[model samples]
Target: MPSSAGPSIDKITEGGRVTQVGEGQDADESAPPVMTFGAPVAGEILAERYELVEHINNDSAGRLVWRGVDVVLRRPVAVVMRYPGGDSATEMLQAAVAASRVVHPNLVGVYDAIDEAERAYVVREWVDGRSLRELVADGPLDAGRATAVGNAVASALAAVHATGMVHGNVHPGTVMISDDGRVVLADARTDGADSQENDVRAVGGILYHALTGHWPHAEAPLHGATAGHGRAAIPDAVRDANGAAAAPRQVRAGVPAYLDDLTMDLLDDSVAPPSSDVLAAELARLDVPADDDYLDSNGPLRFAAEPGEEPSPLAAAGGRKVAFGIAGLLAVALIGLIIGISTLGGESDDPKTDPVAAPSQSPSASSAPAAPAVRDLKISAARIIDPDSRNRSEVRDAEKVFDGNRDEGWSTETYPTSNFGDFKRGMGVWIDLGEERTIKSVQVNLSAPGASAELLTGTVTGQSNESGDKRVLDEFKKNRIGQPFEEHDGTTMTFNGFDADQKYRYLLFWITELPSNGNGYKVGVQEMTVQGS
Candidate 1:
């Protein structure tokens, strides 16, 4: 569970029940104890004053049913366990090891873990909505809704894989609806590693049912027997005299072609499913009502994965060599220009001349002054309009998410809402622009203890080394804090400058204090506009 904010998790005790907690009730006696199995699991009952209620949801492995509390902190949560026969305790432990590593929203939260007594139980955030299996019991989801669900789960999986773990189990039955109006992935550990590859395969299974309303694995559609106003439909994998329901595109006209192809690919085992990274990229590209936001071909730069010596070392080093050479040359020229200016006598008579001379005009100026060189050359003025109007910004707190528009953005403390660790989160962006351009002004909107919004702006230009290309670019934003942004109240941070030209294809902005791990970095954006010289 995200340790970012909200409140602490409720602990478990022996002889607990699921049907007794709620919105406003005493903490000690909320839900009815487990009737099917008497008594709660033994422990200190960390919940200082809450009661247990009835079961809200349960899987074949364990029941995550809800229980109300009898005391103050009256909220609903679930206790998950699959201690029955088939799988051994060791297997469940391994599953926990893998599941505990992933920290993200869409995934369910795993609070407490008891590896003793040959039993393992996970306390997860309780969701009040029905199971997705129940939602599609009558039929699979329409392509539109299916795509939305697929996007959410895919994103969830991407976050899990980022931490080197797999969601071994992914079926309609394991996905759940939250009381908070968000989709939740409920069963990540039930399947284990043998299910890893199938785990990837299951994404397709989910998309299939979501789009067609039929279970490809089942002989006939599970929902076929369900009665509705009209005739029932069959799974996409199966054909009947009436024929399977029209293709997803036929059912819903605007379904993306990639999704249609992805579903069919699941039918064949010979084909390899996409990596979560690749799948995420594709889905991001297929976003709805599409227009051209700059497309980035390279990965992020902050943490560059190294290549083995055997791989073409020369090719990999070529770009860096050229970049280094350019930097060296620029350094030399700056030194030479400063020396020449100190010896020369000519001075500009232009009306616009100031106390400081311009670099282009005064090649012999004694000093170049900290003008363009001081600014992060990573960005240049691809264009500048209305020189008189300048924009300046500085990031004092956390990096914020850019609103689809530029002026408005929000922050997220617990970035990936599923993290098990106490400190983990970040703020990021998916930038859209025609080409690179220098920033002129930077503004950081912050909210600290007693303040609503603290705005700050400055000119710092050492960020020229950041990369924007065919790879991921998780660089410390030129003006962003090295630490992940969290704990601080939500803020809107913007960096602007006009002396440098940004050369990257797209700027997926991310600035946080902790680059090693995600920090509570959630920023929302409103809009960003660029002008031509």
Candidate 2:
């Protein structure tokens, strides 16, 4: 029998109800003992708070899903647990912690994370819904509904992208639709296996699956995505042997030509995917209007006008009456003000000094110091100073760092551990500021929080040099400027000291330490501003 305080997960036998053979029977009633289970059995309250009610499904990565309850709050929750907890579980818990930072209507809410050494689990909102995989299991959905689903997922990704984090995983299994018609994206992995561009491409797969009842990417970790082949066989654009995935229109009817182009463009590696916010807005525009005229995108509000209702009295009179009333009031006030001004003019006093006399100009005013021109000294060139050839390709492209756009800056690849993977010395961006000038300050903006770097200026005109040959700015060595990056407050690095005004043509902004971003060690320099003359 199910308990009133907590729901029962045990099955009923022919003879009677079935449960753990021995539960409270062997316990001493004086004190509640720390209940332990050999396995994740039902009725087990983990951390003495969450009670596991029923087992859901296990993910491809061996994370166990369970429908649990928060005993303190008396509310249902979903628990994703992994046993023999170590690095993998630690990564999962970290991912959960990072995901918890963002709150959105289309994102699954993370409640808490628990690591018991032996096992680690993430507690999240219990969504009463079905995964996108399950929804498209029988057949493809209608075109309009498919676009709506894509729009919601894209909006969620936009939020995640705004935070400088990627949703690494965005397959059918992670997309969920509630019984009450809510669409949400869930379970962001912090492993950094996929990039933001990959997340955009996954949306294309979702569109293809909804139109043809087949998974487009067979290698994707989505449940039931691959049956035999490496990737789910997609029709249409698969040229003789080039492995080009086909457009949706070629595989199924009713798929609009424009929609087909958009879908294929995402799947095509040659073409770059649009930003998540751009894609979301586009999908929203393409979504069909709801059946009711007054409902609009969302349902009607209490004071909203009905479709065929008569105009209200104020609206029928239009804005003319209100305008005339204000004008009349203004006329009365203007008349009284004109009379007062005339009376003051009649009683005017004698002038104290010449009204048109101008202030004397100083002799230095003739050569008025030319306003100090402040312009961004364009970077003559930039190159990655990676001593280790192994991590050469892993370095972010140098061109983006000086592009002047924060959204497209360079980023380092994910390291095995936080401190430069423990072996590598570090990586730096060697830049030429065209010609030497008084460098007043060097400002840097990073993507994630805690990163430590030094503004290095060297006389070496060569493109690259080893760390030993490079000279750190005197202020940094003196512990004046180039302080450690802040945890959450200040990301700006201003190297303004007595020595900062010196002129230097070659400058190296080197990162010596990486910040813990819940994931592994990764840092991105999005914007760099050099204020000098």
Candidate 3:
């Protein structure tokens, strides 16, 4: 082959077998045959073009996969290689060339295939993510996510089957979930192991595993097909005494009847499987729009703060501007009383000259503290924010943090595991004070101890939570108050040392890290108090 960058003959690891670039199957000496030739060292250039970066995974057929970079193109690729002089090597190269001809967004793109006398290799696109096997290992996916994944796989199969070819391999290991939430089917080993019907059946199996967290094809040879302890595991399809799989809805509560029927029909040997295109269309119908199913938490309120700091005043007035007008009327009435009192006091002893002098000093007196007593400032509105933009939940209950009730507070849904389920950066509750006001300090209480959080403040320019708090940090130029509290267990988050009379409108109480709640992770704010009258 002509050299794209350099021409070298270094063996690559198992290529497209695993969805992610660098993950390998569990180490098992009894596993299927792997490459007999020694593994390639890091930095070794293969075909003088693809430089070996890291070893990924060994395929079930025993090919070594590698993560490498195309020196000429400067793009990442996966290299699957085997030792020279075998029917398997020839089949691998031929399969790569064949797959390369079929281009689809859902299918992994093959770049090059070469078979030297010494070794055979196939270079393909690298997906920077985990396989479906890894994703389902944690637990079952939600209905919407499961449907979306199934639709992607079915669509990919529809294209491949249309070209008069077979994917041959459609197991979880061949399905990839990109880091950016894209779903792609990869690693087609069309060595005639299975027919197009088998691929269609596999899509049903994917949906089954996602909906139930149990691979109904437990007896199959696919990696991650069965759980440990010799148990079949929890699945929507229950195995009968004779090992027959039951309908999905029969085993799971939320599985819709139509989805349950489709899943079982595909798996049933007696029933003929639908064509890939037909199946793809059906799955598409079953799939709910992710946005519609998972509504984002409400965003921050846009209007300026209502005039009064009393709790729920904005809620009662039904409109922010109207409430602000009411508060303004109250403020004017209070000013009139103060002026009457000051005038009455000034008339004492020397009425004329002192009153004029007092009026002149009033501007200087504006610098003095307005109020001595600390009050609970009402939070008119709030929204939930995920810095990674992945965890957009909890908007409806966000105002509970300021509901003046410790018993009822706001909380994020429990993630699969702490660290935002390993998929999100962080989550926060952005509180809107209706309008800017002097902030003395804020007290925050959490449901549990040991979670980490920070007090962030920003000024609202136009509307709050309009863009889902995307510009909040930019608005305030990242104004952070107080050191981040890492050991917080429902303690008050006091935001002191703020300019005494400087008005601050928007505040964000962000949770950077969450403490373990035993069943995955959940963090809640029991109460939030803003003290400034």
Candidate 4:
């Protein structure tokens, strides 16, 4: 359950009836007739598999949120149930089914969606963290942290949009951060009432909220904001008398100019929001370094010209054939001038002893190739490499290492000793850069100091499936790249030992030892980034 600092509400469960008691409201007066009429009790088992443990709270739409357990899997799950199902529950069920189709690390996993005529409920991965709404209740996030949150949201949106669908509900409440530092976007509303463009715009809203500690979209009420409930908890954006919300920079100090511009552009009705993928890429580009001071020279994001739209003057000029023709003429004239000078000077028979110099080499005629530009490479996919584990459940949250937020990450299970309780030799996180890319450097940020890790690389082969993952893991363990980073005692590790001449596709950050965690030993990767062409 999300940790809240708000006013407490007393919940009473009697004779299978649930009543919510708030300040200044009597239990009899606050309890609606719906509470006693077939409402699910705390211990009631639904569909004979899900057993409700605790009723968390009721949403604005009167839906109940319960901390439940999947009896068969024995895993915690969040069960969202709405009463009098049938037609009223179609949208929720449909959204769950649609959300379940696309699987991404940032998006919440939809385990099961069931409608039992009288009631409908969605069983989802239970997150043991707070929402963005709760996180910002005290104040705003720093610029870098805000950017990271926005990046995670945009990445999730990109994945959702890739499947030709929209996550209609995208706000602080829907963005969940787990205890282990995983940022996940949850509770997507695929009601068709929102457009894909709107979904992208909502990411900007998320950024605004994160940076300014206020919800920007006052026109559209927040998803869980009720009349006297969650709405007041989230304050509206600070606006001028002219009815314009202040930019993030205006609201807070030290915000990067590029970030402020991107946030405002997303919220601006005049400017078209970039597609989710583009936005995610831009955010990932900005989410660098392990600190909050984002003073990078990477300027504001620029979107490509829309089809049928006029290009900028510089852009148009660069693409014109006349430009190239003029450059060619200039090159020819320069060469001719050089030749004429040489002829007028009466060149000697021996070129080495000539009084006049031969035609000077043009700048473009240089024999040396230009250096490849180093950049932050985009990771297409990532997963945990725990071949020794029986169930491989530890691989589920591997995406957190690359999710942009340095505060959130993936951790190995705690062991009695740093050597994994002497059960396994090691475990790691493997990342795929989509295709082969020039090798440069890889940075890994850990939760604590003194944990030992290594950087290894291997060629990509086999189909991108379960068998393929197994094969890749086997190959990586057998064929080590360079040498392992041994006796590492720092929280941050940078592997710049990559060969400049080599191209790498698959790389592994293998953890051989865990830092002490008081009672036991565990290690967590807060963030990981790769830099290459």
Candidate 5:
């Protein structure tokens, strides 16, 4: 299990009812005996399948969270149990059933929801990770990472909303980051008390908490097992005398003005929040290179508006216009428009295909031919390549590098020395662009400086077997595409040595040296993006 900053405590809320469980607390003496009598014991099997292995904690709402095992499936699971279950656990069970219906990569999988006459328990996927609340316990996240988290949460909510369901819970505590760098949302309430709009606004609160380490919505306290035991775990948002929460940039330095504007706009109820999908798209656009001071290459992010609705003034005020109207069109259409104009004059002259029919080109378009589009290439799939490792587990989460998250990533096991403890040569990530694409630059974001890496390209056999992977690895090693980046001093590395005329399908980012991490050494690919059409 991932470690927490303090003693673990969980706050669970259904509808308007809130329950809190603290460490080392006994059941209340004055509470009903039925609530305390049916507490599950370690090794007890429920529904003849889930065996409780450990009592993790309890919530104030008189519910228990147990780390258990699905004896039949031999997989770890989290069993949340409430006593005297018939009527009291209806909302919880209903939420689990609803969440189970809509599957998403960022959502915790719901396995079973069972209700006995005396007690009820809901089984869910056990995450070997910590919550976002724990992550921000120390301090705020950088703009890039916070954007990534917000993007993930928005995406999850978008998935849920698509099914006409509301994930009533969207707070830091419910957002989980696994050991292999998967961001998952867990514990949906699904009670009718919350609306989809509230869920969208909660993402803003999540962004605020991530970037500023402050919970903006006082109505929803930061949920933590250890909260309220002593000093508050997370402080309320800093507000002026006028009662408006301060922007993230004001609370912390280095937060990009555009990100600050987007977050505040979401939290502003007067200015309607964009739909979950729109918010996800906007955040994905902002999840740029960590080293970038601002979004220059990708331009600004614009929140989508209703067909006739005007874009929010907050979005346009900070020079970070939401993706709407001419601005959005220019970013995507300009390249194609310019390309078409250049090719128009080159086409074989025919009276049927007159130059007058062509779209009016920019004044400078006639001066020079347009450049080919060099946008961010979408990675269809990615896998870690540890051809030399004893176990193949290191290759489990290669997608993390391309998951648009700079904070969570695929990391190598720590070694006593920088050179993989002399156990193997090195490891890397292999990315497939689905189809051959015009070669451009590849940007690799590392967790630390001083790592050495090289860029290589090769063709992938359609085979999905080990022999195919080995062949790909061999080709990558033999046909290195660019010069090796040796002992890079910075965390961001861009390999632009690819021949523009050549097309590439499979590319390998091979790391040769590890950066110093504590007394040992390890390296992490926080984010990797290939730039091409």
Candidate 6:
């Protein structure tokens, strides 16, 4: 609760809940539920003065989740940044803190950074809710929620761009939602080749998914190529994907025609229209049918242009609303398709620069802009919460425990069960990382062996996964990990990088020897935790 200084937990218990002393934690209606990850992070404390709740991730890059404590304040909240135990964690934390200065409401807050004894951590105001990824699967989000998600994230991007930062990872997975359906932006640390335009393209991609209930990986072009020297060039792939939408109106019916037009317009150019702040202004002012309540709740925050520019776009747009849901809509896919694996390679702990997705040749006509453009959304940033960028050295586990009940615990909904689990065990949960990072080691403690499956491990590189001009990373994980959940029977395994460029976020911990598979021992995982790169 200190402005320049943060606090530490006196006696935070494992999986316990803690309250924050601030407006964000005012009431149940106000605070989103706390999500945590298990395992005692700090030393042996009796009752977690701090509580941790776990949430499921739908991105290719694997991220561990948690909430921390104010030992001095005796409160608890969310922290978003790579766990500092892994290699490159230091550099990653530095980048995360640099970007954390980016403040906006629709965006989640970046509280403080704590680094102790050479370990690091990043904390923020926890949304205490779900994500857009979750809402899409629950059923098409009501139009209000959808628009809120779009408009809010746009506002967040505007702030990010205002500070010259970019949210490189912009999938449905990065947006966080509240219990009552408030939207917050997650992963403020997207770096390297991250840019304002990519963030815009991601917004378009998000809008497309919200409306259609389909997860779209825009086969976006990086200035025309994914090879050397071209990745920095903004890609029109998102626009191409938006344009490729079979029926914009048909997919979600009520989307204002103009909104669809805007999304499509975003995709058309290889580069983003302008800085996110500018684009945000455009979002604020663009004309829409009157009486749409979603946009009204989003207040007009100041757009940061000096003296004066043209009228704000967001003001004209009438403040649209967008809902937050974290469980991805298409986790359980009946129709399968392979996606290009992440080209950012090397599992070494060192912060080797992420291989920028090379810009493509013969760039789209729209991307040939004279300069870097920022959007004119003009929407003011929402107030999530934040602090100084101090990297913390501990991780708090999710307060909610996995009970093996498919509906309640873990992200069964996000990752899906029945078809996804291969159905051999009682319930199975797995994550597929899109990029490869050095995994120092992993430990799986089963809650109960009865339903546990064998945790399998393997490696896949970008070069190995690439096929001609395209790469199918999803296919590499599913076929390589999904199909053979049964092959990995026993215990621990160590695997290395799969590419000069890594292909996926994480290696699947598949279950091959389920009790149903006749061993009768059952597959149980009390905890599946990975430590450091």
Could you give candidate 5's per-residue lDDT for residues 141-248 as a string of tens digits?
766677777877888898899998898877777787665556678778866888999999999999999988888876557443344543235678888888778888
Least well predicted 10-residue stretch by lDDT in candidate 3: 1-10
Over the stretch 1-533, how does candidate 6's per-residue lDDT look in tens digits? Answer: 11111111111112212221110111222432343333234332213233444332212222334555555566655643333235646654665676568665566666566544233455667655545544454555533345556666777777677676666766665666655444567665544766667788777767766666654443532212222222122222222433664434444333544455656656556533555656555555532222333223232223323356533665344312111111222432322322222222332444444334534446453455463232211111211000110110000111111221222222121112322234222222333333444344444444333233333334333321113102222332344422232324344332322332323343344433333323123333343444333
lDDT of 1 by residue, 1-533 (tens): 12122111111111212121111111224553344333343332424543444434333323333443424545555654444313455555566556666766677665555544423455556655545555565555534356556655666777777776777666666655444435556555544344445656666777777665655654323212322212223334444456443334334322434466666665557876667655545544343221111121122211112344332444344444356567778998999999888746445665455346534556565564554432322222211011111110011111122221234333322222322123322223333334444455433443322112111112321221112221123232333322333434444444443344533333334433321123222233333333322
- Candidate 6 overall lDDT versus native: 0.41
421-483: candidate 3 lDDT, tens digit per residue: 566556777788887787888888888877888888877543333354556645543788777
Top-down lDDT ranking = 5, 4, 3, 2, 1, 6
TM-score of 6: 0.41
lDDT scores for all predictions? Answer: 0.42, 0.63, 0.67, 0.72, 0.73, 0.41
Selected candidate, larger lDDT, 3 vs 4 = 4
- In order of appearance, the predictions have TM-scores of 0.41, 0.46, 0.49, 0.52, 0.52, 0.41
lDDT of 4 by residue, 435-479 (tens): 989967899999988787777778755443345656766787765
Q: Mark the 10 consecutive residues where model 5 has the least summed lDDT.
A: 1-10
Model 3, which residues run further than 4 Å from truth? 1-38, 223-237, 291-533
Quote the lDDT for 113 in model 3. 91
lDDT tens per residue, model 2, 240-317: 255555556545433544456677777878876888877776776556443321111121111223566545555344
lDDT of the structure predicted as candidate 5? 0.73
In candidate 4, which residue ranges exceed 4 Å CA deviation? 1-35, 224-232, 291-295, 304-533
* lDDT value, candidate 1, whole model: 0.42
Candidate with top lDDT is: 5
